[model samples]
Target: MTLEETAILGCALQWPDESLPFLTEAGIRADTFSHEIPSAIFTAIATAWLAKAPGGFVGIATALGDRLDALGGAATLQTAIEGAAQPVTLPHYAEIVKEGHSKRRLALALKAAYKQLTTEPTGTVLAAIEAEISSIAAGRDKARIQSTREIVMSVLGNLNSRTDGSKMAGLSTGIVRLDEETGGIRKGGYWVIAGPTKGGKSALVRYIVRAVALDQAKPVLVFGLEMSSDDTVEAMLATEGKVSASRMRDGTMHEMDFPKLQAAANNLALAPIFFRDDVYDLAGIRSYVRQVKAIQPDLAVVVVDYLQLTEGAGSADRREQEIAIVSKALRRMAKDENLAVIALAQLNDDGELRECRAIGMDATVQVTIEMCEDEPGARLLRLRQRQGKTGVVVPVVFNGETFEWHPLAHEPEPASGKSFNRKRK
Candidate 1:
């Protein structure tokens, strides 16, 4: 028998009440004990304790009766008594047994998956394995409780590390006033960038990618579901080189733009901005994120161009249900991976989300972008913010030629018939 099994059994026989909490917390059951004697002894002890009977070694042995006699009766009891672990260390010993149990459970699950693989469809097998794994993780998290002091210390750590309240606590979007209002993009944040079709949502995300990855020298992953990877790259190149996307697309770039385009390409070559335009579902996105995180631990953010375009698991028949699943999965992924997720979404003129309202509710920050009726570019309105005020609209300047956007720089107009603020490019 392993020392852990022996320790747990000994504690259960001698100090049932003391070991109960650890056993309960660890979710250890009688079947978890490796040895038959230990398992039986633990079962008897637990039964006696639950029944309000005296649960000492003798009491447990009596309760066990012939089962103990078959295992050597008094001598077995004496051995367990002599080898009893310290009462103070019961929890530690329980953890050891719990870890072993977890490993055994995983092995069993793998075996079951392997058996099913021969007869089941690949997707079913994979889903079964994933479900089991998720269940294990969920069980652990459910059992683990964080104290208020620990949470407070975590909050304090975040607060103490930031010298400026107005600055972003996480990755900066590179817009000064917007950063001040939204406190910048943060890890575990679910941000929705909503706008009408072709209303500069992609341009905004491109700027965000440049700000977070290129300018700040961090890593970012983009899931460009709406466009091909090459098209995404070209758009970024135009934004970076300050060239016209149309000119680049038609191979009609001016002679003077060659050097600028080359420079932009070189900068992008060195930038740690990763892109994948082929992912069409949430599982694919999650798998890709895991792969990227494994290779690039410093990955700071994940941008998905238009959430409604992505599919969900196979069972979701309705679009809204599919979107709900995707939204929850994306949010869970952000928290699980500890990264900011900026997912682009589409909004109608009535200000309702295009596919699912769940995205609006699930998002940590909901921002709507619309073209300024009186101006040239778009205005970003904070529809909802978890940590800040909403309804704040910030003017944005979009360079049509470059497909880049930034805060509009307001310039004072001279006293005239039509006095107005104009944004200089």
Candidate 2:
């Protein structure tokens, strides 16, 4: 063994508080203690002695000494320890001391010592360890990636499946033509409903939640970041009862809507839908989705009212960066958990609202709903299916009184005007 190793072993052998001073007098530094072998190898030995010692330094040192002498003669060991106390200056020692043992510097020191003793290139040694870790990680990631792809494929395949030749689940809103064009919300596929401020995104989401959860009995989870749980519930009740959200909040339902309100409340209470208003962080949302899935293994759908409201691990340079991180995470969670995740996003500065052209989504299908006074009470839901197809626009009408989405009775012809006449002929 090298002189350094011998000294470390000696220190490790002598652990008692009384003996610690002798080690210091012998020139060993106490605070620089490390359990790393060869370099901090003595520290590990000292710790092991300390674990056995009851009172303090004295008992530990005694126990350690006993083990060392049994392995070799004390005189021979002393020879090995004689010149081992040469002082060596460590870079960033002050910073390391300030940061404590777990800092990166300490880790690097131990790693360097290990590399030197093993006579291996530092990069090669690190790569070997990393390769082992990466190998295990790759296996796990491969499984996850495959499973996610399968879930998305399954959902899409089911939606387009022709065995029954009927729509799987109709769009919750009254927009019939829109429903016919896009085939109702497909399972396992992500849907983005984005628009500008005051575009009634929240209202539109509430309508879908009520339709799917209450009316259709599909298990849905809504991550309501923009609104409180109570407010979400109230809005849902309003949509269900065919009453204005204001009336529901005020507890003043019209006599005509009383029966509908009662039924809606009953439906909501029994629905399998779960709402989580507390999930504001992106990581928290990911965790909650896992937890929800654990309970409802077959959870069909998840909805985030709007993506911009969600927070990530830390604030970024701009809102766009934050949204990008959140968007990627949400898409990952969707595929990982095998559930359809529908997230609402806001439009850019430009007034143009189209699904395929919508910015910020890395995965899943996107649909933009443009609300304008010219198209009063009507929402133009532009459908852009990225994985499959694109360029399909369907006009949908929102019934103010019923709080429902209905497809326009007549499908709007393309702006080209040629298609309309071609169809007529």
Candidate 3:
């Protein structure tokens, strides 16, 4: 161990209370210690601090009486104390220890990255590097507590700037009626829309992204893990170009449809949407978002085509555990990044979502979309919002050619099973 590291550890052991704040604030984890004995000692001290018990070496030794000799006993403690620097400079010394530890970690990580570069694609290697750098930056910039008065003043400033009395504080989702009901999408919000097979989940998500990115001019990151990027682009083109998706897929588009398709393609080519279909892991998504955000700091939204497909780090054998982990990470990302997240989920007939119950638990707004039996081109969006109202169903009509959903032209009789079309007034 370096002289500075030894001194910091020694200070932490002898004057635990006096040095606790400095060590903690230095963002030093037990692994940061160079030697096994000091690492173990630091771990014990951290445990004592959390438990609000005596944090001195004697107290730590007593707590780990059985393992004291393994941690080098009194001799090790004496050596650390003898080498210790001034207690007043403990924080400064702790920072040096932390910097050394970080360099060691970075070296190890870079070694692995070098191996990955030979085996993995360039994008994959870059993403891994981005993730590592972001993790380090986050540790350095961890948020501190804020005063309630200061928080209130900041919130008031936000409220005062908005001319609309609308409570929504984020980008609009582009659906007029849905926006009215939910007050538009809100910052740091997790929203889930669940539906059955062929329930237009992808269609709905695309429209929202198109609105936020193309029309509203906000940057968007979309993860389309279920489908290939090429297919996603084609579907979007069909929806935006007013061309029949089947015709486009079959290469049966009419001569007249060529103009519309070209127009839509040109418009979308300049959109602020960033699309990816490869990543399926939560960590990769976080890394990719951070990499993109560096260039477009104004990124306002993230959309995942479906939730069940995403995987995480740990052994998630059970479906519920997997869901919980994925949902929690996504929720944290939304809050930390302060962007709206729209995750689509599949629903079983029993009213249970596939894979996890955490989808409903973590979502700020849970919405269900199903075909409107009485209306051929319309779907019902049943809103169950935890942040606002619940049990409200907004009728929406989808123009299959345009792939857009709009408010119902007129109110319909309750449970009336009459078929209808998308004729707007």
Candidate 4:
């Protein structure tokens, strides 16, 4: 009747009633009834027995009564049986009957019991438990093999998809020709918008963010490392309100602009766009991405103000090396999160102006905007789409006030004159 004897009996009688006589002949019953058993142990044994038994209520009740008598009196046995049954609900009992009590179930039961006993779910304790589960589930030995295969397949898929250039979302950049050529900017791409100093990189990113996040109502996260959160918000307001950046800074908005500004502010306040001014290194950025994914799993895009400003964990021989690392991370994050990451990158100085190029072969599209002094403050936007090629090219004017790109009209190419008048020799 002791706990140990009851456990032995439970295990021995677990299979069938056919085994019980053998167990009794082996002195199991004599040993079990020699000392008083814990009621809990007796209840567990009786439950296990009844679970496998085909007997009706009379047989089960008889066994239960005998076990209760061996484990002290009926009241003590009933109390323990009630306590044990409280933990195993009808659903849980059914599950145990179906799948049997696994180690995982036992652990879960222990955890639930601990939580019930403590009456608290602190972060540290919960995290430890979660970590244990994750670690067990990870199967570390297979990680390297699985990771290698995943990377290979991902790269291959990207390569195969790149042959047919990306489709762009309709941006309000007014550049009909550029939009026609490159589609808009495809989702799930690391779009590098690079230009020289004062070349309106930030403005361009702001334009895209507004066009995509506001106009399209797609959720976006803007990581503004260079600008403060307030400055970024002000820039967005300026773009949305069609006010000049200078006017916003100087607080010298025209009387007519007030209504537009008020409307922009109201819209912005309710926008599903999120902005973070934290100067995150690559690791920090990755962590932020994970947090964002947990909350807004359906995020449409992420916009990093510029790549060069962000820090990463590498001792690059040059700044480009660091930029490459950051670029790859952004691309990977975009693919993993299934969101478009439009990152602004700074171009290396080429004479007086820096021009944009696709950072790596991973990018889905690349766009370069050049400001021309010949036309007296006209801007030319050139696009290089990764997938398909469309023979469309034109000049686009950047409206800093509204942060809009307006396509400029161009004259048709002059017809070449032929020397038909030349005498044949």
User: What is the lDDT of every predicted structure here?
Assistant: 0.76, 0.57, 0.75, 0.56
| Top-down TM-score ranking | 3, 1, 2, 4
Predict model 4's lDDT versus the native.
0.56
Candidate 1, 149-191: lDDT as tens digits: 6689988877877765533577788677777778788989999
Across residues 17-101, which tens digit of lDDT does each residue of candidate 2 receive? Answer: 4343233333333333343333233443333332233422343334446554444434544553453332222122322322342
Provide the RMSD of all predictions against the true structure, rounded to 1 decimal: 21.0, 19.1, 20.3, 22.3
lDDT per residue (tens digit) for residues 298-393 in model 3: 778999888888988768888779878988888889888778889999877555677786687788887777666566787778787877777677
TM-scores for all predictions: 0.61, 0.56, 0.63, 0.55
Candidate 4 lDDT, 317-411, residue by residue in tens = 76667767778788988777677888776655441112212263446765555556545345655454567662233566677666666667862
Colliding pairs, model 1: none
Better of 1 and 4 by lDDT: 1
Point to the candidate with the largest TM-score.
3
**Clash pairs (backbone) in predicted model 4:** 1-32, 1-33, 1-37, 165-387, 165-388, 168-184, 168-185
Q: For each predicted model, how many residue pairs clash, with residues at least 3 apart or on different chains? A: 0, 19, 0, 7
